[model samples]
Target: MKSIFRLLFFVIGLSLVNAQEIATTDATTPDGVGFKSKNEFYIFGDAVVIGNNILSKDDKKAFNVLQVNNDDTKMRYVDIDRDPTTFSSSQAALKLPSDFKKIVYAGLYWSATYAYEKGSRKQQKGNYVYKGSGARSKIVNQIKFSLPNQEYQDITGEVIYDGLGSPTHLINSPYVCYADVTKLLKEAEVKSGAYTVANIKATQGYLSGGSAGGWMMYVVYQSPTDNPKYISTYHGFALVNKEEPLDITFENFKSVEKGDVKTSVVVSVLEGDSDLRGDEFAIIKQRDGSFQSLSNGARFQQNFFNSSITNNSIKNRDRLPNSENTFGFDIAKLDIPNYNNTIINNSTSETTLRLKTEADRFYLYFTAFQTEIEQTYFDDIIQDNNPNASVTAYVSPEIVRAQPESDPSYNTKEKRKAYKYTKRSLNSKAFKYLKNKKSAAIAGIEGGYYVISGVFSESLRADKWTTKLIENGLDANAFINPKNNWNYIYLLRSDTAEEAFELTEELKTNYRYRDTWVLKANLD
Candidate 1:
């Protein structure tokens, strides 16, 4: 009787232990703790499968199913059995059947949180966050990859620009823009290794270890609107920083004077290790008339190539395009306390500056990982398969301004006396129709809109007295040396000159621009 009782107790205790282990395991495993990382560094989210039927009508009539074997049927068949693995690269994408309609986008969620510990100046021991055993430490600079293809990869790093604090910046990875829903889901799935399943199953995973570790998982969903080109679909857990304010000064983007408009200034630090020179550091000037040290941040290691210099005509300076420099150094961040501005000792404030000339130029704080980007079909594939179908792609931004020209002749018969003040009356009429026409857009050689500078020249004496008007604050060069072929014009993008003339009657100051032949500027 004693032996029998002992055996029964032993069986019950083992069963209880087994049940406890199974309860804590992920959905996919009865006793397994989590999915293993394919590469040495990181684990991926579970793979998800999603597809929708594409139905096509024979004609555009109310009810037309006249032909059973038409273009619509062929399109539906093509969409039914698409191989997600085919569109695995950064730019790889698949096409949706044109005859078929209705796309269902599906994704997966693979979330796991862990304790995060960050090194700090105040604590010699360092600060730490407590998390459950399954939690993962945050990863700042790490590599991320998609399944089935090994050639394509991205480095994930933190971007702390705009004084918005810090957010994940996945730089240097190839980006994709596609309209197909099936292609996006395929790129967002995990599809390699031992714990593979025939169909995607819900699973709990543990992701821990790193400076700012936490749990994470893969999540998938469909977009309500038709995904436009140049847009991206992304999902992941990350830290959100405070929003940074922007101040627009005419010094670069516009022609307005400093202190003319009250705006919040902020600096956006670009992440990368490109060649930077001492002159680039001078770009940021403090109020006390001191320059920030050029070698203040971490020394970056370059993995790419040699250095080359070119004259950046757009910014009116010679600089490296691929190199890293202070990108957005707005004045607003300086005004705020406990933000970007810092008071050193008793007299000066120090602010770290950052920049990127081109989109590819990134500053080096940590390794940049292309965690995820929009997935799309390759340009050649989309064009070959469907000639009429258009694939949206991301393009670079270009500056559109008046091209420089040769010096104006200024050799009129009476160089100094042409279009002399003809008792002109600078009144409300000078800016009569202009107040309502404050803004206008023009056709650009590049893809985006180009705002034309307003040209104000007396139609009768356009060529004459243009120099005098230019001295009084008009872009004489734009009219004199235009890429579109025009000489002897006075242009203004702001209301400064026009406003000055309109108020001439009230002040009677400046000796009378009213008599100086004023006319509304016609912007082209």
Candidate 2:
């Protein structure tokens, strides 16, 4: 099944390279999907709104469509960056926790409603008339990005969905694209700072549906103090409405059986009204498989997809202009564990998500789910507290020494007996012994002595250290010592204690591994 998926992705990649568009049958379905799982936390932010306003419940009845003649309602560029050279640029701040040690992944997504400006807009018989035809552009996937204290650089991404030529989007065509920016963020001097995105293509006139354009950045980071989690990101394009509610199913992840399970979801949508109600987000309950509506204090259960960017119940006001209503862009993170614990408990390894609206229509482009899972540990060996203690302490000197000086010529039989006695004495010292086990049988660890190079309390740090060792031409492996729950990274393994001891001394000669030590397992 894994090979089949890989082949499918390969074919999809080839097609994308040729056509540069993710083909979809209609405007209300996903053309492609991408997923990833890791032990990390994710944060996202977006910008590029021309106007901002506080939409009241009463205002929902006044506006039949989002495109109005007012200056605040018009679709234009939100040039908050104040860079005179760029055409359409906006800035958004990414404020990650200081404790987030490393960035695991970063993705940049941009979307827009395009192709409505080529038509003539006029009034006929007290009704607005639009004669424009939907069109696609070749440069829709090209964009410019700027990091803090840096200049703009060109970037091109894979087009996830392009709806310009689709039959459903005749006047208000929309498209979404994404780029993997993990390498760029990792190379940056600082991960959290103001980010600017420019050259996003979108209609800037009064089209049929409300004109909208923006760019978003999703970042996943690792912290040593954070719990082990299964983080999965999925991307697609679809429309959810009253007639056809979208249901997305998530699987292939395990959850912890004990303790408070932490799970959260992040979603990005377009064309959702801030004043409108009845747009609901629901997830199937693990207890009885019932769909429970999800909402926070700022978002009502009936209006879950209102235009805003939020983390939990807190509205993120760290962007330029900090618009109260983002016109139509919505990026939010909902805490599932805080909403209800009984629905998504320890038994939940799979669940389905449903999104529907009674009076509003919107497009869903991206969604991500993260949940706490059982932490995995290496089962290579049991940890001994006093690893440096003398092995001869357990064996009496008389038993290990030659039988007697009187036994001339050092009888080989007596020597063999003493060696056997010493081995038996060591076995009785609270140590487990095994023999002739294959390397695969013990978590890819053979029965041998290990030369440990580093020890860490966190698995993520241990993994990082092991990677650095491998990059430096050393075959490194890591395992958790169950006794103390500490991670131990080993550089070499040997079949004999003397060989392992000699290797440790040789490694200690290097300044990097000056504190290297040896661990011996009683494997016959």
Candidate 3:
């Protein structure tokens, strides 16, 4: 029976709440978490970095960093125009706050177009051109500081920059050059009153006579709090197939800032063969310090039902076997206050954690943040099998996303949606005339049990997933049962039990829903 359960688990993966106001594509999972499309890390709330909303094209969109390299000051609130030769006198800087706010990351957005002005070879009249080298290579730009008058350094390290294609080949290319200047900002003292921020002012020696070329620095700041929580996921768990342990490194993830306290650690294990005691995972402080067990109040793992696979177990038989195991627990046993907890330490928080596998292989996920600081997905926007969100230069608190229907086709998927939605001003006369313009189907949903993908406890999450399914042209619904405390996110419903069962089987085998099951309850 257990083997049957394992097989089912292997064939079908686990799931979670798909909240409304979401999108297609994977959210920016920190480099550590192996789990993609499941977890995320972002600021708790929204913030404005450099509200540059000054462009006729794509004007409504907010940009923390804007480069008026086209020599158009109308495109930015604080435009820094300069030629390469005037570096000494043509530098620009923004003063930031010295309070709890910290610059998490920074980037330079690249954008340039050819002007009617003559070039050396030809008089290109209004033709478009690209910035940076033609190839997908690194272009280093100078950024200086004003607080202590420090020296300039070339921004380098694990940065993700997008590539805009050649001038003629690409129509829409939103590319950014990423850089992290956290260490430099942390050590620099704010000038007498303001944050002596970055110097993102420079130019190409050849952008002469109105030929556009400029640079903008996108600054990301995190406002500190009395209690800051952090959540993170790790990748590369599949690389280890045997019963070997993997190190959970914190160096790459910016979870722990200065002056933090040790909090709880939740270790999630997916597709494993065995159960885990809360003690299997340990937090090792420093390189040689003692290992601390965080399993204070451990919740034993719960086994979910897999209908695709059946076994000889009397209660559940005749179906395909389900063999997958999923479990997670909080570190409740360790005396966090007694020792210097690396996860909660005020200085140099947890460097690494050790996770031992129960069997041959499994995927591990964890989020460790200090008090009040919790982990979350970026604005509830996630993607599965979709293009990734482009790397934007400026960092905001979180993203604002619309929910997806069951099919979850991208907004770009024109065929899936019935109509195209365009943003219009509230004051527009057409909006008033078309305010009541909404279309409805000729018929309503049929009655019967719903063959659902997953049941969620959160109504918001259930509704979110339902929207995605609906957008995909599926008859998805989020049925709530207050008495049973169930929120079923169903894909399709039928009038008869036999039909529902057949549909469930079809979904399991044909629709990639190996664990799809039927759900029925009283409407009243």
Candidate 4:
């Protein structure tokens, strides 16, 4: 009787251990947590499946029919590079705008559903059961990563959540890990390229639900041609199904005070089916505090997690194979402000998001949100008047030119001289529009030409430089360019290009202003 009681207690304890689900938690901030920048941010990643031709072209849209772990599916390595040393690998491309100046922060994330193999299956009461004991591994957090045209390097990351360590992770046997790759990317100057991740350690055979694995890189970059934005990235492991829905609330950031506000969210999920229906992604509306389903041309409100990487209604075809359905992996960017039923606006600062499914069960590992914010400008500096000072060089010049001459050689000589001066000026400096031509609203100061001294990403730095110039008796002021959110410090503004060009040339003679250039304020 004592032995029986002991056995009962043992069973109870084991069940309790298996009942605890992995909890979602925040990753350590590589650049001080929450939202790292008020600049442009984006994400790029790919699914790491072990096999090719898993689904036929005919099964692409066969809703509720095909699955990753279907009986007829054969599991194999998805090695597009044909590297003989790696066990399994996959590649995804990353692309950023040419104007992206610097990377503020970068986080690498990789996840997989491990240990559901054919040998672990057993029949109990006419139902197949998976033990999944092989899922636990001490080296689960180690993986091989390669940048474009580079050799693979081994990297070990922090385990965000491992099902083997969770009390309730046994149901699906999953794990997610992360590493701060900001320094690596900065040193390597990785702007855009194909990234390959290998040895993810996921089972290829079959699992009770479905098999899935993937890696993602979330990056925050600074750009002189993008609006000031609040960007935040969150990482963890949680399940969303009919019985348990997930809600993630975001705060510590505010929207722009006025004008049009744009907000977006990016999500990375695993085990979502391309065919299964009933998964829903939603956000709490600020107007009514009610959940509103998010939908686009590529995603449906009732089936948001349909195993595809998308930006709004458009699908991304930047990766190798670029499969129509990633088996079960999903990464998407949803522009909330552009959605027809969106309730987010200028008044929104905090928000709550929810994910649930009635027929499909999937794991949510990563979520990121970004929104436009008011531009930060430098404070105006006061200048003291000095009677002994020389007159400013920016004064409009009087026109002085010889009248047209009858002699053909005289005209040719004048034309040649003018062309030489124009060529020399253009070759010595570069210029760009202060505002985008497509923008409807005027940007920067109300001048046709600006003699710019410097451009800065941070307003504080621009302010500091402007202060020094004012102290030195230079009539310098800074203005925010609405088109790109960059602070431009200018020494002079003129209505005519000739006046601006003359002032720029005069300033170029000074060692301190050797790089001074002209900015055309109006392209229209």
Candidate 5:
């Protein structure tokens, strides 16, 4: 079986192109095909049977043809093997397409059929054989045919008929499948039209079983009109769990973390122009509980998929005397991965490959910074009220950690070197969502705080102090950059110089850690 694994793999790959039509035997079809009800009027296709074969006495590999719906109200059967009538299309009681230039695989499942008896005197009677219309043809109806092979040629092509015995014409015998019908159907051109930036357009409707995911966003428009359906539009580019289009904004922006849910987490970026058939890629679920393509917008750019976040909590230390509090961010960070370069034709526009953000630098009109004061300090008041109360506190903090910065200086010629070091330090495996949204200049980055520790008598306390600072409300994740020996801890959600100073003052007043300093905002 392992030797034939490649063959099986190819078959499975071909199956995906037609996911909607092919149902597993365990499942009932949407049209109620598996029901026992009589009025359902089941339809079936023709079968492929081997008749007069020289190799085997009884060919077991034969199949039937597809039967028509509402065409004939009768049923019949024909032995694929040794049945001269089966191979003769001239007197084929039923008619196939005249220009029937091709037959890929016979659609066995969708075809209709009836039953017949075997090895009885009545079987030899005309009632045993299936007749298309009239006569004593016993109508043991047969439907559906399995594909023969991968070869493809016009049904009108010439072939040498076997001359071992009497002359015979293998007319409709699928014994030779010279036409690659699978490829034709998959790459079939169903629709062709374009629209403006936000215009809604509809091509042909897609397969309903969530199989035709690539076409879902375009097909499932609310009104199906040319109007820009903002809210009703099913955008497949945001978090995958909830179906909603993220209004493009650029205020209060931080950084996009990888694995922050939109669809399947991007596992790996494959080499070369995007291969639509790549096994690594999956579906991008849309707002309407549907899915669409998440292929990257530009070439040589990273494509992103849905990402996951393990720990949303990042912290910084308290600098005030007799205090050990931690701070965190209001917004949670999810994970996302970089995409491999996608492929598109000359007519298609490039894709935008940045993460969603809300800031002035990343998004011109929008701001990503979100801020609010801690009106009721729960930890502060909780301990004062109930000295020994075993209570769980909501670990909400003021500063959320963004993807760590390597070098705040973005202009130096050495910046490229800095990025190389930075990419490696972040482990280059975690998710970042803000990266993609920043490219369009419509997202924002929020403000957060990091922690710095003062000199302590014990080495463990120095580390422990920083951890405790994060526990209260700080983005004090240790960003040990190799170049600067200075331990720069950042904080989230500070808007101005005064606000940063106030935070620093509070830190100094609360925890007695040594020299705490603030880094100036680099946003221009």
Candidate 6:
């Protein structure tokens, strides 16, 4: 048997772009991954706003699809351009770069083109509101393409239209169509970007005179071979844990410090255009559940992705593109070379990359890869942990002593809550919830004011911190805040803030309780 990691990473928004229909001779899709296409249906257009193209030139690097809804039931809207240079047609054609190579990936995007919502439109409904027969397909589904000699040819590949479960669209719903044009594209590849042009046109799509929208298409493709090192298969997973403004960790991600394999983090704009991905960031969570800003230093890498796109000049990854909508780059700083040693002197070993984009409007995908070679070796050792274990990141006395020591006293504004599990026993109900949340081993509980410490979204990371603290000569334990459902590194609860402050200093100065923070709760 072989290790298989199947991910639908390409699903950003707008019905996940029908990634399941992608033909791959290599790996199997894991269960509970793909979705039914018909259920994601809509008429040729819904929520028609004004736009000439599906995306502005700035949005070219990323797929621009829109969805509406609250925490539940994401409703999507797209503008499909009907062809022949009509008034403000949203139609777009992908022009290959002159030095194009094999197209490893492509997607045909169709959005709600309902041109007109005359009279009045309904606002609310049951379960979820959907298009009725009145909103059925206004145009015929006959699809055409712009190829070399022939002006328009019928596309032969299977067209998987998006969400058609509704009674009306069951007949003909707007959808994302996937046509394998590898042969056609390869034949035209030699033309040096000029010989080939592909555009989608639902030319025969007919609409009622009363209808508001009908016609055209939008398509986006990624031809990685244009660069010398192509993406054979981007092996990684998407972190959609809770959607926008998320803190995520992929356990399967492994690498050595200074390793050849680099981790890339790309956040697609489902709803933003002012800045690049990773442009504005909130530092890792603090005791009061606030974040520090990295806005000034947030970067954009010019030459990292496609140097040609930047006119051979390297663009800063954190800076917005001139086009303004599309941006992605590798976050070398966030890579965890050694899991355990991620903490040196109680400071963050792993980088936290969260965007403070206007209300955090984005989706994230992460990929890891080394060069195409037999093997790659790393000679640098930024950190090394357990002696008996492999030379990776581990917590040791040297690392602890190397950390700076400082403790702040009596600040109430931040509402910092720090807790350390005191050996003092608790009631059955509280203990049960504690167990469900998880219990960490402590050196021993003591009666003293305690300091605020670390916090983690994952139990494994929290546990490692607990162990490291205990080893470095202190009673440390993992506790769960059943309220927020987060794991934490805390100290025994203290009777007074003064005593707690004293202990905080002791731990910082003596035991290297470096990044410790306070934990809070209402006793009454």
> Over the stretch 301-411, how does candidate 6's per-residue lDDT look in tens digits?
211211111111232222212221221112222222222332111222233334433332322222222111111111011111112212211111111111112322222
- lDDT per residue for candidate 3 within 1-524, as digits (tens), equals 00000000001001111111111223332211122222223442111121111111121222222222222222211222232322221122444543323444333332222221122222357753433323322332343333335544444332222223434213222122233454666566642222222333222222222222222233434443222233332222122223454555443123334444544433323222223222245566553576553332212212211101111122111111111110110111122432444434543423555655343333332223223232211211111101132211112212212212234223422454432333334454433322222211112334455676665656777777678777877787665544335465677766555566566655644333443555442221
- What are the lDDT figures for the candidates, one per model? 0.20, 0.58, 0.31, 0.57, 0.19, 0.29
C-alpha RMSD of each candidate structure in angstroms = 28.9, 15.7, 27.5, 16.9, 28.2, 21.6
Error of 5 at 364 (Å): 40
Candidate closer to the true structure by TM-score (higher is better), 2 or 3: 2
Better of 2 and 6 by TM-score: 2
Work out the TM-score per prediction. Answer: 0.17, 0.65, 0.25, 0.60, 0.16, 0.31
The Cα RMSD in angstroms, rounded to one decimal, for candidate 3 relative to the true structure is 27.5
| Predicted candidate 1 versus true structure: per-residue lDDT over 1-524, tens digit per residue | 00000000000100000111111112321111121111100001111121110111211112122122111121111111133532111111122222211222322121111122111122235643323222222332332333233332342432111111122322111110112123433454332221111111100111111111011112122121111111111211111111221111111011112112111221212111123221122113334534332221122112110011111111101111111211110001122121233211111212223222222222211110001111122211111121222121111111111111121112212233222222225354434433333222222222211112222223334444455556666444333213223232323233444543433333222332322222223342
Stretches of candidate 1 off by over 4 Å are 1-251, 254-283, 286-289, 292-524
| lDDT tens readout by residue for model 4, 1-524 | 00000000000010000111222223432211121211122111111111111222222222223343322243344555577787767667777655444555667888877654422556799987654444345578898888767789899998877775444555556777887776777777555888777777765654667666667777765543223454555566666668766777765345656666678888888877777889999988887789888999988998888877777788776666566566677888878854433577664657878888899678887777777644321000000011221121011011101211122121323442221122234333222222222212335458477777776657888888889888988899878766446577899878766677778777765545544666655444
lDDT of 5 by residue, 1-524 (tens): 00000000000110011112211122222111111100000001111111111111112232112121111112112123243424211000112322222222211010011111111111345434322221212211221112222222222211111111212211101111011223432243321121001000101111111000000001110111111111100011111111222222111111112222111111111011111111112222222323233333221112222111011122101101100110000111122222321221111111111232111001000001111111121112211111221122111111111111232222333332222111111222211211111111111223332223332324364467578777876666443323212233455335444454455545644323312433322233
Report the alpha-carbon TM-score of model 2 versus the true structure.
0.65
- For candidate 2, lDDT tens digit of each residue in 213-318? 6678877655432234555565666767677677766654456667677778888887776777789998888778788899888688998877777778877777
Query: In model 5, where do residues sit more than 4 Å from their true spots?
Result: 1-264, 268-290, 294-500, 503-524
Maximum-TM-score candidate: 2
Root-mean-square deviation of Cα positions for candidate 6 versus the true structure, in angstroms = 21.6
Name the better of 1 and 3 by TM-score: 3
> Which window of 10 residues has the lowest lDDT sum in candidate 4?
1-10
Give the residue spans of candidate 6 off by over 4 A: 1-52, 55-134, 138-143, 147-150, 156-175, 189-524
Off by over 4 Å in 3: 1-48, 51-148, 157-175, 191-524
